[model samples]
Target: MAKADGLDLIAVGRSCVDLYGEQTGGRLEDMLSFAKYIGGSPTNTAVGASRLGLDAGLLTRVGEDHFGRFIREQLAREGVDTRGVVADPARLTALAFLGIRDPDTFPLVFYRENCADMALEAGDIDPAFVASARAVLINGTHLSQPGVFAASMEACRLARAAGGKVVFDIDYRPVLWGLAGKDAGENRFVADAAVTARLQQVLPLCDLIVGTEEEVHILGGSTDTIDALRAIRERTPALLVCKRGAQGCSAFADAIPDSLDQGVVGRGFAVEVFNVLGAGDAFMAGFLRGWLRGAPLAECCEWANACGAIVVSRHGCSPAMPTWEELQAFLRDEARPFRLREDAALEHLHWATTRATGYPSLTVLAMDHRSQFEALCERTGAAPERIAGFKSLALRAVDRVAAGDPGFGVLLDGRFGMRALEAAAAYPYWIGRPIELPGSRPLEFESSADVATELATWPANHVVKCLALYHPDDPQELRERQERQLLRLQDAARKTRHELLVEIIASRGGEVAEDTAARAIERLYALGIRPDWWKLEPDDRAGAWRGIEDAIVRNDPHCRGVVLLGLSAPQDELIASFAAAAQAPIVKGFAVGRTIFADAAEQWFAGTIDDEAAIDDLARRFAILVEAWRDAKQRAQTQAIRETA
Candidate 1:
């Protein structure tokens, strides 16, 4: 039986990579580009459930390859537990090529010869793990093959023995069962008595059964929908759900209804269908979300229908599933558009919620200084052109310090550091480029007033770092101007699909309260500006850091936590700040500049140190800060563990 704190659901079978053609209303042969996403019936359901706030796990096998690792990592990012997801050394992961030919026709081709997922054996089913979930869901495709069928049946037996419900999704794929040609991946139904008999053998063990109209027809071995329901009911007393496409879904608990309209019906939403590939999987996920919580049948069907509606109007499968917050907002808003894809607010919500990279910590080298570098060159009697070469050398130092560490990043400007930025683009490091004009009090863009047009030319990996010299106590007109500029930048970042990092320096406006920075952040939130990252001046006081953390969490929990910025503070002072900020979990890492680079730059400009010597010195200094930041984080973690103990 499932323990009180065990997982909510475990989905077994069919994990694959889906390469969806980007061009709509085009055949697969004519498509030019494709967007990759994790797919497969059970995998999509697991991702959908996790996104909708369920403690979901996936039980499947992926090959030992790049795509396999990608599938596992993506699943973890979506909050699905992957303990049961095995990596097979013998086979390759499956791939599905799909194109949206039109609203109704989606061409699909599966490259599944000797795929790892289909090689699942009964021995792979861990009884304890199977019992750890309150419900175990197995799709019909797994039962089409002998080895996977054994594994699926074993999971069902273990789940039932441990008092867990078994959920059956008649995920009928005719090509998978060899009833159709290899190219007929989109073929939903193909009547074969043998396939129906095989499905009937597993139907009696299910506690709940869900399928589209065509799927139920195959399961019940009948051409009629009502007749299929009756046939399926005789085998088991499971709660049967019939997916009626645009008409929503119908549920039957006690008896098979004479007609679907007579049963408990959940009305569907009015939305244009873009692609119907993974809609059923999404519907099952939404239904399970409510059913596991003991919600009413009508409520479960409502979520299911809404989820289906939303996915059908969007592009990819798992990526299209709505988060719990998005789902609730859509349900609550009476003015939502009939075509969900046309709703800008909902689209932004979906994009923001679903597309965050998993960067736990970032140690950045902030050398985006323009005026300072030029001034140093002038003071040393060196040509202004030397500044560009110096920025490139600084990038080399960054490369040395951040070699294999994905957590390291660089903040470079395009004016003098364009060469460095171009070189840094080749690496997988977190690259941020400054958008705010240097030391601009009202936050003016360096290139143009139109931020979106400027952002369109930037590489996708470069984060938009805008340093806002903001203060809550500023004169109303000045503060509003700065806020307006920030709002424009935020919108531009969203449109360009670039992450925005708003660096707040509240002290720039003069003497202020300890909570001044936090207040400025709160003011921005009030103006509907939600940055993906917040770069703030580090405070040595724990209370000040906590205030900033509280504001960020209260406003946008999805906002990537803050990174401390150095305002040319001495190395010792920066380290001290790290210790203080480390105590706040919201402070991720530091983006320090002058403390590591000023002395090196000055020496190199004055001919006191050669390029090699300067690079080595800068690398050493940056490494020291990285080590100090890590030590402080370790200490903070230890103290937290001690407190909890």
Candidate 2:
């Protein structure tokens, strides 16, 4: 049985792989290359809806082939449920080649003859899965096939019987309809009495129906556009949305108006057009965003328009589809949430801070800074010899924490943290090494010139931790230098298959900006650099982490979350910061340096306390922080469940 509230939408029908031409202002023959992305109306809508943080699912058939595997994987990665996505071993998945003719037009060619999706059988439909969804979505093409037609009918029946709404996307693809003449101009739709009669059979079943003028004409069986809408309205008062490109779309839930091709429609957020394909699917997703959230009619249309505008300005449909946070963020900015959900970067920074999964609860013992250790030794006057004992104390703590097979990691440098690294190597624990050197703006590094070569030899769990003092307020030269350094590290990790942990301590007092960490993260992604993990300082609110998390997820969906860094603050203060950061799902655990082991180092270096006692004291503080992290993770998850409920 599907979990209650598990699947909000189940979209059934054709899903294909889209090969978009890379070369612009060209014909199909003129294009040099093509970009691959998930395509097809139903698939695009499901992916788009999922990007907006909806609990969506797909019900379709694909060939038991590479393309089919890719479709399922992409959907699952986007958080779409795919249990209903069946693979037929006999046929091939559908494929579409989209060519860039000009800024306004994209020439699309369908290779769907005997495709897997078109071969859907009645036995393919799962009654329980349909019953579980809040809405059941089907495309008009599904009705063109006898076997799939029965399947679509069963889905509609199950959804209605289960008290769920049925949504009809009048996605007219005339080639699928066997229309072979100019009567099928550009393969949009052909106004036919038989097609109109066929669509009318399901008109009464839909709670909401979306289509272009051509699609409405095909569905309503009338030559005149308004007449067709009026015919559908007379049969059923299903909410109708007329998609008019560039001018925006209209909504009618009641009787058709006498107005000539216009009404008091929701205004559209207009932007320069790139490719007009998939605009309809994007509009539907946007409308659903408002309708499902129970927004007013005007606002629903506004959201739809806003979504379409953002998508048009961007590239592919589903990849360009904005998240709820992204859309909300663009809305706030366009007057818009330009970051589209980079706020998720914070959640990525928060609860899920850990990208590598060896540890259940990470109580990191951080004592990796060389300068700090050297300074502590200089100040205490007991001995520089005690620094090795400091690593020893941290190692003891690691051993203690790791007793139950629950893993832990330590941040150590090859300079001062050599003994700690040597000791940690023996155990099955997370090991992090600093790849970038400590300095001011325009950071300096040794192996960064050949980071990829150096990193290729490291252990898989070896997370290269680099600390850079970067903020948007920095000089342009400084920013460029930092970006270059980060990309260097990124290239290394990508080649080595080792984990990367970036610690950006934005220089404060110079800039009193909010979301410094997030902005810094955005800068890295803007440079096409994505780290496996981010090490961040605590924020006052969960919202502060959103940008960082969003950028991480956007740049690399497989990103390990961000961890909290103590920055050597007092233990009491570090505990409080952990409490704030723990509430975020993006935060996996805390990587504390000074606040955790500083006190022990000072006493041990001063000869005021023995090494054994210092280790014990460090162990106690470490234990306290570990318990705090566990407690915080639990509380955050509980709140998450409650919010979901």
Highest lDDT scorer: 1
The digit string of per-residue lDDT tens for model 2 on 139-191 reads 89899878888888889999999988899998887767777542222468666
Give candidate 1 regions above 4 Å deviation: 1-5, 181-183, 342-345, 355-363, 367-409, 412-462, 466-498, 503-529, 536-557, 567-589, 602-645
Give the residue spans of candidate 2 off by over 4 A: 1-6, 180-186, 260-264, 335-480, 483-645
RMSD of each: 5.3, 10.6
lDDT of 1 by residue, 152-196 (tens): 999999999998999999999999999899888999999999999
RMSD of 2: 10.6
- lDDT agreement of model 2 with the native: 0.75
